[model samples]
Target: MNVSIIVPVYNEAKTVERVLMELVAVASNDWEIIVVDDGSTDGTRSILQTVCQEIGVAVVFRDHNGGKTAAVKDGLELACGRWVIFQDADLEYDPRDIHRLLAHAETGHRVVYGKRRGSWHRPNRWVFALGVLGVDLSILLLFGRFVRDHATCYKLIPRSVLTSLQLRSVGFEGCVEITAKLMRSGIPISQIPIGYTPRAMSDGKKLTPAYGFRALGAALRWRNWRPCPSPAEHTGSSSTLPAKRANSALN
Candidate 1:
C-alpha cells in the first residue's frame, strides 16, 4: 500500500532533518513524505527546501502559520497514498514506530494509534494527569468512550478516512478533534503501546496549560461532530472509515 507520511513542522529546523533521514532509511519507495512547513520564520524553511530537493519529498510552505490541523489538512489534499501517517517534525516521537504502525495497518486495520502508557509519579505528573483526566472525562460525558491520552501525536489513518475529515481547530485541540471524530465515526481503531519522552518547555515543546483548556473547550463544542463515511466504504474496503460526529463515538 502507498503510505504518505505527513510531518507538520513549526520552528523545528533543529531536528527535522534527522526525522526525514529516518523515514528515507526505513520507508519503502511507494512511501512519500509530505513536510508541511507551518510558517517557520527560522531556518526550518531553508532546511526543508534542501531536503525536498535532495530526498524528493514534497515540501509545503504555508502563507502563514495555521497550526497543526491546517498543515495536516493541506498535506491530505495533496496526498496520493493509500494510507496516511501523522508524524511530528520534532524527533520526540520515534520514526521506527512507523514499522509497528504498518504492521497493524497491513493486517487490515483502518485506524491505528500509538497509545502512551506510563505512570506519572511526580507532583507535576499529577497535574498533567489531572489535565488528561479532565479532558477524558469531558469526552466521555459528551460522547461515551474513554480516551486514555487524547493528546498523543502518533496516529496512522487510512488516506480516504483522513481526507474526509473536516478539521477546524488551530492548536492542541487538533488532537482531540481528530480522535473524537475518528471514534465517533465508528471506525475500528487499534492501539499499540509506544514510548513517550516528555520534553521541557525550553526545548521547543509548545503545549501549555492554556492550550490544554482550549483543547477541552474544542472537544466540548465538537462533542456532536461525527465523521462521514469515506468514498472507499461503498467499494467494500476494510480501510474505509466509519461515520462519526463526536469523539465519544469511539465504541
Candidate 2:
C-alpha cells in the first residue's frame, strides 16, 4: 500500500460511520484505511465493524479504553504502507485534505502537518491561543523551529520516520512526543494550511487543560533527546528502503 490512513476512534458513534464513508470515498486501492476502535462505549465499535467490513477496511478493537497514542501505536504495527497519515474520528477535520498532504509527499516531504487556519472555533479564544503559544514556544525552545499546530491530527509521516522514534506518551501528549522526536531526528516538517471546525465541549471535545499541561511536559522532556540507531543505520540494510525512497524523491 502507498498510504496507510490510521483513524483512532473513541466514543464517536454518531460520526464514525460518516467519517469512514468519507474516507472510503476518497481512498483508492493504493490506500489502506486502518481504523482502531479505542474501546469506545457509545456503540462506536459496532458502527465501525459494519462500516469497515462494508468498505473493506481493517479494524482493530481494544478490550479497554486506551488513549489515542496506544491506538495509533497498534495501528502502526499493522500498517504495511510506505507512508502513514493520522485521521481523527471526529468530523472536525476533512478527509479531503489528505489529497493535499499527499501532493507534498509526492514531492518527497517526509513529514507534513495540516496547519489549521485561524483560531479554533471554541468559545474561549484566549484559552486556545494560550495553548498554541505554549506548544509553539516549547517547540521553539527544543528545536529552534516554531510549529503553528503541533497538536494537529493530520500529521503525514513516512513509515521509516515512525519506525525511528521511541514514543511513550499515552495521552494526547503523543502529538508532542512525535513532533519533538521527529525534530530531534533532523527531519524537516512542512506545514500546509487546512480547514478546521472545532467542536464544542458538549460535543465530545475531550482535550482538557490537563492534557495541554501534559503535552507541554512531554515537549520539555524530549527537548534534548536523540533516537537510537536503527539496524539500517548500523548495517546499511534494506530496512532503509522507505528512507531511501523519500530521499530519492527529494532529489
Candidate 3:
C-alpha cells in the first residue's frame, strides 16, 4: 500500500536534512512525504522547501505557527495514501521502522504507536513517565483502552482512521486527544517496540515538563468531552468527522 508520512516540524534546522535523507534511503515503496512548517522563525522553512524541492517531496508551509497538532492535522488532510504515519523532524525515531508498521496495517489495526523502551536517566524522564502513567490510567478508566504509550508521535494510521479523527489541539495535547478519541471510537490500536534517541532540551527539543502536564490534563478531559467536526470535514466522507468546538483549555 502507498504510504503518506506527515512530519510536522518547528525550528528543526539542525536535524531535518538527515531525517529526510534517512526517509529517502529506507522508504522504497510508493510514498509521499509531507513536511509541515509550523511558523518556524528560523531558516527551517527555507531548508524544508529546498530539501523537498530536491527530493521531490510535498511541502505545506503555514504562514503562522499553530503548533505541532495543527500542522500535522493540515498535512493529514492533504495526504492521499492508503496508509498514513507520523514522523518527528528530529532523528530520534528511526525511519526503518516504517516497514514494521506497514506489516500490521492489514491486520485491521487502525493506529500503531511506536513504544520507546529505554532506561529512565534522561532529563525530565520522571515527569514524563508519571504524566504518561496518569494519562494511560485515565484512558483506561474513561475509554476502556490500555495503550502502552499515549503520546508517541511515531504513529501509523490508516487513511480511513485519520479521516475519522476530529482534532483541534495545536500542541502536545494533540497526541493524547487523538489516542483517546480513536480508542473511544472502537478503533483497534497496537504498540510496537522501536528505538528512540532522547534529545536534550538544549538540542531544540521543545516538549518540556510543563507541556507534559498540559498533555496529561488534556488526555483526561478529552476522554469526557466529545470533539466536534473540524472545518475539513467536508473534504471527504471517508474521514467520518465530528462537529467543531472552540479550542477548549481542557481539550
lDDT of each: 0.75, 0.80, 0.75
Q: Could you report the Cα RMSD, in angstroms, for every candidate shown?
A: 8.0, 7.3, 7.1
Clash pairs, candidate 2, are none
Pairs of colliding residues, candidate 3: 163-239, 228-242, 228-243, 228-244, 229-242, 229-243, 229-244
TM-score of each: 0.85, 0.89, 0.85
Task: For candidate 2, report its TM-score.
Answer: 0.89
Backbone collisions counted per model: 12, 0, 7
* lDDT ranking, high to low: 2, 3, 1
Q: Tens digits of per-residue lDDT for model 2 on 1-251?
A: 77888888899998989888999999877787778878889998777666766666778888788899998998887777778899998898999999999998679776899998754556875686688678878789878887888989999988767877967877788999998998888888999988888877689877876767787789889988988875342211123333333233223
Q: Please, what are the lDDT tens digits per residue for candidate 3 over residues 1-251?
A: 37878889899999998999899888865676777778888898778767777776666777798889998898877676777888999888889988888777557665788888766788777777787777777778778769877777788877766766767688888888888888766667888898878787888877877766787677777777654453332212222111111011003
Query: For candidate 3, what is the total of clashing residue pairs?
Result: 7
lDDT of 3 at 28: 63
lDDT of 1 by residue, 47-166 (tens): 877776677667777768988888888777667677788888777677788889889877888788888766555335566667877887888787787767777787888777776777
Off by over 4 Å in 2: 118-121, 231-251
Off by over 4 Å in 3: 225-251
How far off is residue 126 in model 1, in Å? Answer: 5.3
